[model samples]
Target: MATKEEDVKLLGFWASPFSRRVEIALKFKGVSYEYLEQDIFNKSALLLELNPVFKMVPVLVHKGKILAESLLILEYIDQTWKNNPILPQDPYEKAMARLWAKFVDEQVGPVCFKSVVKADKGIDVAIEEAQELITFLEKELSGKDFFGGKTIGFLDMVAGSMIPFCVARAWEGMGIDMIPEEKFPELNRWIKNLNDIEIVRECIPQREKQIEHMMKVAERIKLA
Candidate 1:
């Protein structure tokens, strides 16, 4: 029983990368919306009603219509709004962006979550997985500012959503400093460019907060 509003509404978890992806798209498009933060541990009835399948956050409610899955919601926003296009107009480029978005969405978050939470065998696996994910990004973005070249597009947002996760885990938890300024120069430049953007900075969840949660989650995983 929600009131009718002629605007977008986002039901999401603050620290979730999936939620961040949708938030980034909304910011880029300048689509003003109400943001409802949901606790993953104790989901609200509203969230459950909006997205019953996964029972997850990042459910985009537009004019009473609900959209689940971050990637699909982004595409829906781009298509519906028809301004500040996230994907390239060219078919081939758009297809490539979609592929990378799918690739990163499928792999990055789960692996990083495992690294943050499970300190046992999962940690070792997550490290290797993280390296593999980073290597893919390094090669894909060899000499470009973003995956879309000079602009943060769909693929950029898709991959960039995970930046806070990797940065926090490496610098805070592991103290590994994996994404050094020299090692992944392109990545470093890209991250700086994204960080400098006002909308991106404002919408993105803080790295320190994510790190703190990661520590708590890790301990819980160990005890469990």
Candidate 2:
């Protein structure tokens, strides 16, 4: 078990999945730290100073060294604490984990969720595209308990944060079943597994607040 690190501080938002994932990683490592709830809608000077490039939440400040980007921060946490290893020991598996994690961040996640969340504007991203993304996931999850196998790992922290209630319920609220249990049993099972973990559930943002925040982000996108 990792002891409390007084120097480690997290600047995060309540409804940001990226933030939630960092929190999950921190809990997994059992590294005690300060949780600074940031207003992502209104970035603070500290957040701006820490991460001027993106000015994003989920910033991990350790020993006065600031790290931004959720994936990078997760890796830092794993390397720094060296407890509850998030990555696989096998190099091949680690590479594959990284591959899918990038795919989630770049290809699959945004294309699927942005379409539904930004529905108010005339955004008509084909539902088929979203379904295709889910199909890729369903296939990848075949015969495996998780993307990183039986235990949750780096990819789990990356993709799991994005694929749960916010995306599914957001699509459902739009009268679109993005992931039907029967059609995507493996993915659904993966979701169930993630949600079943106490720490993962604890880090999850409150449902209503999350949805409200999603709508606010959509509105911001519309006006922008």
Candidate 3:
């Protein structure tokens, strides 16, 4: 539980879309937090202590309590603030939201990253899997401004962070077109709309920097 005296702090890496998810949630909820940029390659002592098990970025420290994982942190933010609700009120809708969020994070996101970074070896298979995942999501998003219908919700936040910030950048860096505008018009529009939001505008990484970082990762994968 967060308190008035104890400050909210985020430990994150700039290049990680996972970290951006937490940032977007905090901003959308109108929560003021101290952002601590972590060097993921050489992690800081704070990050190490807070998330000793995973040793990863996107860790949230509130009132001296540590919360790891972006999704969990997002839910916590929504629960604590009670403003700009991210999750739906209904039980079933909330469950569905969680389902899609997990799918994007666990399945779609990994496949897209594999497609780009391992392009030389497994681009075809990875791209096919990614396309299938995107197609399913496109169908789910049909006739809606967002996955949550009217406004950006939990699923929107997760998908928005992964698609535009991570997958799109990976494809761009690899010189491939995964989500062609003509083929996936809805997804494209969703990306545009989500990014246009003020909180997202403040949190999303620069295109050039994302591409550069992804390209470097691709090169490393090739060498490995």
As a TM-score, model 1 comes out at 0.87
| lDDT of candidate 3 over 41-120, digit per residue (tens) | 89889889889999998999888788999999999989989977999999999999999999998888877677657665
* Shift in Å, residue 51, candidate 1: 0.9
Candidate 2 residue pairs in backbone clash? none
Predictions in order: lDDT: 0.77, 0.82, 0.85
User: lDDT score, residue 10, model 1?
Assistant: 93
**How many pairs collide in each candidate, listed in order?**
0, 0, 0
Flag the better candidate by lDDT, 1 or 2. 2
- Model 1 lDDT per residue over 44-144, tens place: 99988878999997899998789999989989988887877898999999998888777776666565555545645665565665667777777889888
Off by over 4 Å in 2: 117-125
Query: Local error of candidate 3 at 110, Å?
Result: 0.9
The weakest ten consecutive residues by lDDT in model 3 span 1-10
Identify the runs in model 3 with alpha carbons over 4 angstroms from their true place. 1-6, 119-122
Q: After superposition, how far is residue 74 of candidate 2 from its true place, in Å?
A: 1.1
Candidate 3 accuracy as TM-score: 0.93
Write the number of the candidate with greater TM-score, choosing between 1 and 2: 2
Superposed by TM-score, candidate 2 places the C-alpha of residue 101 at a distance from the truth, in angstroms, of: 0.5
